[model samples]
Target: MKIAVIGTGNVGGALARKWARAGHRVTLGVRNTTEFKGKELLDEKNISVAEIEEAVKKSDVILIAAVPQATADIVKLMGNVSGKVIIDAMNSVRTKPDGFNNSFEALKALATSAEIVKCFNSVGFNVMADTNFNETIADMYTAGTSERAKEVAKQLSIDAGFENCYNFGGDDKVALLEQFALSWINLAMMQGQGREMIFKLIKR
Candidate 1:
């Protein structure tokens, strides 16, 4: 799988390294090319770094790890990214009192000819990279309309070293954002435990 991971932040960096290690041809899409020069994990895992359009044009999956507000613009930049799967891993957290209607932008981005899946936005970079706990590793939850998109999400999760992943299903639901935020806040509150902890829903 040729994957393009935009945004050089923790999320993108982690995913880029993981997939590249998994033997996929991975390209990193960056706002600034110079920011990626010193990543030891990148080249070690056979990852190539490129500008936004180049990455999107040459990959099987385009993982949008940019700031939430920047998503649509990148989608426009990659105009007609049809027949490719788009995995959105952005988190929309506004400092302002009135929060953004986050799902609206994701829906708009899906306007591009692409299969969209909202995922990898729930957990921290540590968990995403190597999730191993006392019992079992964490599960990566994914929500997407297309079955193929969900399958890609699950495959990506497994390739990234997760023992389990759940396809939570559907497309562009506002409820997903609410669930993400609520989980994020709770995870944030667990200090000392730090960002390594993950939310794993289990049933008896």
Candidate 2:
């Protein structure tokens, strides 16, 4: 799978590395190719850097880990994303994109032609980096109306070392998924529970 990572921050960097190691072609899309948050990622095999539009054009999937406030601008830079799968890994915790409730909503409105899903936003970068916990791996969650996008996200989650990628629900559950992410943030940061912990589901 060819993936375009639109943020280059901790979350984007970690996933890019994981996907690259998993034999996926990863591209870091940035405003400035000369300098970006995760420039070191270019040194990894199967990972390269390109301008926003170029990266988007070359990849089948785009992972957005950028700041929530820049959602609109990022969408504009992505050009036409028709038939493309977009995985929004951003949360509106501190701030949301102007005129939108969250990144997922903003992307849905701006990139109307793309299949959007919310995933990778419910866990910390460390958890995404290495989902392994003793003998088991962490579980991933996603929510969106596009079954195709959800399937892509689930496979990407598995590629990133997660044990399973559970479907939360349809588009209506997108906000709930973000709230679930907030719960994790509250526990890990506000409650001082640490970021090493992750959420998983068990059944009989």
Candidate 3:
């Protein structure tokens, strides 16, 4: 699959590397990708990193791994995204209020032509690229209205190294995942995990 990752930061960098290493046609998207400092990463992974619009225009799946605060405006720049599979990998937490906002709303406002799926969310970057838990095994959770989109994401998850991706619910189920991330943060504060641990939906 042709994958375009929108962001050159940690989340985007890590995922892009893994996807490229997994042998998918990966494109790392950034505002000014040529000026990005992480060129060595893409070079090592043999992946192509380019401008946001160019990457999106050439891919089947467009993954948003950019900053939460800038999501709306950035998405606005990538207009007419209809019929594309948009992967929402951003956290829209409002620090002042100590809560969350809706990434879907921002996507909805800007991406009328896209089928949005929320995944790779709720978990940290390391855990995302490496889902090898002990026998208590974990599952990647994904949500999307389009069955095809979610299935595509499930395959991407598998390619990214996850063996089990739970088809938990539909697109609107994103809130539950966002709240789960918040809960993970709270527990991390208590257990000294510092968002380093991952939350997997394992069987009881």
Candidate 4:
């Protein structure tokens, strides 16, 4: 899959490396091609950097890990995303997009032509970097109105070494998924569980 990753932060950087290692063509989209947060990612095979618009234009999927408040501006810079899959990996726990409750809501209004899904926001970047814990691997969760987008996210999750990508229903569950991420934050940070914790589902 040809994927464009916006925001070169820890989350984006980790995923880019993982996907590249998994044989996916990962493009790091940024405002400046020469200098960015994860410039070292360029050394990885199947990973390259490009300006935001160019990267978005060429990729089939776009993973947005940018700051919440920058959601609107980033979508605007993406140009026409018609028939594209947009995986929103941002959370509004700290700040939200201007005039929207969260990044997903903002994308719903602005990037209407794209299939949007909320994913890769439930865990910390370190957890994303390495999902394995002894013999068990971590699971991922996603929520969105578009089944197509959700499937895309699921495969990407697997590519990134997650054990599974569980669906959290549809668009209505989007906010709920963000809250679930807050639950992880509350435990890992607020409750002093540290960052090594992982969310998993077990059934008989």
lDDT order, best first, reads: 2, 4, 3, 1
**Number of the top candidate by lDDT?**
2
Clashes of each: 0, 0, 2, 0
Estimate the TM-score for candidate 2.
0.99
Q: Rate the local accuracy (lDDT) of all candidates.
A: 0.73, 0.96, 0.74, 0.95
Model 2 gets an lDDT of: 0.96
lDDT of 3 by residue, 37-119 (tens): 45777675557877778788888898887776677666766665768899887776652111236776567656777888888
Runs with alpha carbons beyond 4 Å of true place in candidate 4 = none
Expressed as tens digits, the lDDT of each residue in 59-82 for candidate 2 is: 999999999999999999999899
Clashing pairs in 2: none
Model 1, span 15-87: residue lDDT tens: 8888887888888876566666335556565787777788888887988777777665676676557888888
lDDT of 3: 0.74
Question: Would you give me the overall lDDT of model 1?
Answer: 0.73
Clashes of 2: 0
